[model samples]
Target: MKMNNYYLELFEGRKNIIILPHILPDGDTIGSSIALFYALKKLEKRVYIILNDKLPSNLKFLNANSKIITTEDFEKLSIKPDLIITVDSSDTDRLGDRAYLLDLCSEVLNIDHHSTNTNYGKYNLVNSKAAACGEIIYELLKKLKIYIDKNIATALYVALSTDTGSFKYSNTTPLTLRIAADLIEKGIDFSFINTELYQNKPINKIKLLSDVLNSLELHFDGKLAVIYVTNDMLKKNKIDISDTDGIIEYARDIEGVNIAVLLKEFSDNTIKVSLRSKYDFDVSIIAKKFGGGGHKKAAGCTIYDTIDNAKNILLNTFRENFR
Candidate 1:
């Protein structure tokens, strides 16, 4: 559906705008936010991209102009936004503590591609058919007649590439690649972005990966593959939670593995679960069961329980749900 003209008018009328992304911002969230930031700035709009967490070290390259508002910066701000545009978040709760700030804004616009999006916005432009939220944002910018500069192109490319696993995942479509090709024509150093985000792994990340792989276990006749990362493991390796980013892919790629799970303990006995399916299986269903959501092949949720408890629950769910 076309974005409502009321939202377009709001965008053209609003003076102070804020672009919000989900907490623990990933590549897609950060990239889409930054791309919009540039697009709005081109129109001389007062805009800020506020995120609840710091950018991951790998994705910091996408911040072409060093413009990103962290929770620390946002807390001290005196300016109330006229408009709030949330990108890449499936639901308002995904905004984390920043969700409350919506009350201060006159309008809320949610732009996402998640199938589970709740449309929690005064005006929402959600396209579940899009491979990533970046695709939706790209279309929005085109409708607004914003020029896609090198920086914007690079950011959108990062957004599209990361969410689609550098165009290797099942979610990638012909249109996805075509948009990427157009972005490349804008003179983005695609090779550098790819290498920096994917190939250049830190030593701490390697240590974390080793420990995680060592903890790997295959269950239910090798169909359910699981790996656990404890706070102690992260502390011992001197690595942050971001280091565990893509380690679940290793477990899921194992031969004969149907569903792969990565369980990591955060603080206060809270465990985060990442799920991946190798075939036609729907991991998002399991994620939604745990009060979280994502695409069919990859999804995640957080469980406020012990590691063992979370694992047992997931195992039970898999046994009962898997066909």
Candidate 2:
């Protein structure tokens, strides 16, 4: 939908709207989508939020918890949506099995904060400066005269928390914190949400994290840290992809390590690459070279080949870019 006004553009003569987030949905993805969902519902627009991954339990308290459409449901829906808005999706392919939803809509609006975004939709408001897409959604809500309620505030708060790394990441701006202050004043329980969102990991997740961290390997004068989680690793630990979450963060926390890469083996010889940088490196450029995109500090891609090949490509590129 070609919309001069942000909110009005999303509504562009549409009754049924489908909102999609990227696969492996994070706090920003879910939070941004939920905030928009709240505003869209208040306008009485028929919006169905579709997500391909499991809803991170911390966000269940949001207003649209019951309204989320899963990947399974997206496949079964025969009716095409009048408009489709995708939040935090780096590209059309990032929609995974639900990429078909992009085709089902008459118009597509892309909302995201990734520096490496492909701008895949018909309409896009991509901002790399914003800490989280939820913040952009918050700005969008304000423009539409949407009320700042506890549910919406709580959802946006989670988005800020995660994207800013709890305000520790460089992405956190003074404006970001000011917006956060406004969200907090809306009677959203920060203490409860904080614990639930950050502290409430499953036991299996913790176990898998422990196993993965113990197997961490360092290279390149200890500037790089790599954690490889194979199919055997997942099966032996009795943990799936969900359990592999946060393993990269453990590697990033290592002293003197400027870069962290998590290698998760997928079906066939494919591997997923997650790159997180602590210095002034643009991870997105590396990711974009690999046909992936994200922020400067964190970026990722799914390599259709071996872990070694992927790592070599990254190393060669890093050497060319930074050495």
Candidate 3:
């Protein structure tokens, strides 16, 4: 079932398409799904997107916003799907409640760029080299012979730009810029997308970040900068876990910091960890030891225990690896 070849026949069949993303959908999830939805609908095909979480405010401007369904809405439906295309989700569990949707679809297409992807689909197009799933969707559109207008370009732009940290991350390869260049040439407003996604953080988020930065701790001669945010901290600022998005970037950007870790506590007292590095540190290896996985430079894991326990495991492991 090679999608690269079936571009002709697949587009002709009118199917109830379901496009879904992983829990806590990011820019890559939203942008890639939206771009695919637009292309499918333009060809007079039935397409819908289901997100595991609410759409981030900044990404609400895509042309096909109305087509996105939340997990709650899908539960109330009674329709069988012709195709289920997952974007940015590595495993079935990442789809949360929408995992049931797989049973309703005749075919599954899993698209992702995560190095830790589990390839848990009938068809997988996992390219660790791609900057974002949006880039893969862009390629799929081209294979399907769909034209990229301004709106489609913008949708893809946000996905690649944010996932690559505005083209500053190590994942920003030569092809990444080529896709971005094509999108920009299509008249997508780069400045607007950048401002909307990065510059428009809520004031409370900024305040919470200030506190996280102030409370940051260092280990191994400042090679690893660790920050923690408990549920109490969330209640203190009236913010959700999503508000801590860029805190790790702050740690990674600090002078002399080769690696950064952000330990986030959920309401259930589980501690989620993010790991980022400046060089070939292979944070994915670190995350794997904790039953999680991701990219070489940026990865994450969740421990169903205290931050102290997770931190100890990390510190001890860091000593073993980098010390």
Q: Rank the candidates by lDDT, best first.
A: 1, 3, 2
Compose the digit string of candidate 3's lDDT tens values, residues 1-323. 23467544555676678888777677888888888888998888777788656565566556445877776676687667777888898677678777888887657888888888888877788888788988888888888889998888998998998899999987888999999999999998899889888888878788788778887999888888999887877788887776577678889888999999999886475788899998778999998887778889988877877888878878988898765
Please give each candidate's TM-score. Answer: 0.96, 0.92, 0.93
Q: Candidate 2, overall lDDT? A: 0.80
lDDT of each: 0.87, 0.80, 0.81
Model 1: per-residue Cα lDDT over 1-323, one tens digit each = 57666556767767888888887677888889889999999888998887656567788677533677765687788888888999998887788888887888758989999898888898888888888889988988887888999999999999999899889999999999999999999999999999989998888888888889999889988998999999989899898886677889999999999899999897767898999998999999999998899889988888999999999999989988655
- Candidate 1 vs 3: which has more lDDT: 1
Compare the candidates by TM-score and give the number of the best one. 1
TM-score, cand. 2 vs. native:
0.92
Candidate 2 lDDT over 1-323, as tens digits, reads: 12247555557567788888887777888888888788788888887888756665555555445878776776687667888898998888788888876767658888888877777888888887899998888887877778978888998998999888888999999989999999999989999888887788777667677777877878888888888888877787676674465568888888998989898887667888899999987787778877888888999988888877877777777777545
Name every residue pair that clashes in candidate 3.
none
TM-score-based ranking, best first? 1, 3, 2
The lDDT of model 1 is 0.87
> RMSD of each candidate?
1.5, 2.4, 2.1
Clashes of each: 0, 0, 0
